[model samples]
Target: MAKVSILYPIFRNQQDVLRDLKTIHNQTEKDVDLLVLDQRSGKNKDSKSRVLQLFPKVNWIEKQFKNIAEMMNFGFSRAASDLLIYMPPNIGLKPNLVQAYSDAFQSSGMPGMIFADYAEVLPDGKIEEKRLRDYDGDITERGNFGYVKGYSLKAAKAVGYYDEQFNRAEEYDFRLKLSEHHDLIRVPDVRYDVFISPEKASEKMSVGASKLFYPGEGK
Candidate 1:
């Protein structure tokens, strides 16, 4: 059995799925189970064949989830690893992403969540590294942590998983909830490179958490 479960939720993003699958396959830590919760009908046989040939070990689970929270909840329920990572299709992880988490969590007595730093993949293929802020009550609450977070399955279950109400801001909401009762840490490591729009990035500054709120839910 794998020691970690990467919950990668996707819609109809086959191309990006292929890329992310390849990235997962390249992780230094091979003891991992990738649970791709795809909320779409199905891909064509040709595309599936091509990708599967490259990484056939994927644990593909097709489901119709309403939002990110629901998709994550489904993955959490079926997690095979003690460590659960919420990895979106758009995110790009380094070769040591899983290995980094494994090493850190094992040494830190397995905190509720171990968050790491990330780099931005610029439009021209340039990489700009962004480190996580030093853990502080005022900093985390006002601002937000970047992408690339390693969640503890035990802690996630205690908080009742994620609230399906928050869509894009699920990470923000989740961290807020986790910080309330768990030991949140800011590890200094560039383990991921998230692709962002040039317009959204402020010159050399990092983009904060995405604001994904439903009509009924206030932001």
Candidate 2:
């Protein structure tokens, strides 16, 4: 089987989905499985059809989820590989992302989760580097670390997957639990790019700020 499985959630942005898919399809690593979870509503039928037309070989699933955490839990349960990459919509992967993650998994003695530095694509078309802090098991760390992240399927399942009750900060809750049993490794290299719209960026900031006050909940 593949060394890593990429779980991608598709939303309303067809252009962003297509762009990220192209990058995924062009990856230098060949032994990577991609599972696309399309969460678009019935009104987005045309967009869904276009995606299928362009990438007919992709493992596409049409399922509506009540929350992002539920969608993530479903994706992790279906991933074929033990190493899972949770790649949200509007994120761009580097050519060596899979290979780098695979290498980090092996070299780090198969940590529970892996995260790397990333670049941000500004609206003005400029790229800004975002170097993430090392995982120090700090409860006060920002919740919006980045969009693309790596997780150990076994570790996630061990922690009972993500909590569906949280529509926001689900990942934060999941990571806090995962870190309890396994190591959270940070790769120093930049492996992906986050393309955040202004509205989404604002939402992320709010989530990050809220996480500071409620760090004791997930534990």
lDDT of 2 at 100: 59
lDDT of 2: 0.60
Q: Candidate 2: lDDT of 214?
A: 30
Clashing pairs in 1: none
What is the per-residue lDDT of model 2 for residues 30-97, given as tens digits with 9 covering 90 to 100?
66778988776565566657767976756888888988778878888888888888776554444555
Tell me, by TM-score, which candidate is best: 2
Residue-wise C-alpha lDDT for candidate 1, range 1-219, written one tens digit per residue: 677888877667446667667777786466788887766667545546666687677777667887767777788889987688767555445555556566556666745754444433333433334532323221121233425557777777876888879544455445444544444333232222233222322321333444322232221
Candidate 1 lDDT at 86 equals 66
Best by lDDT: 2
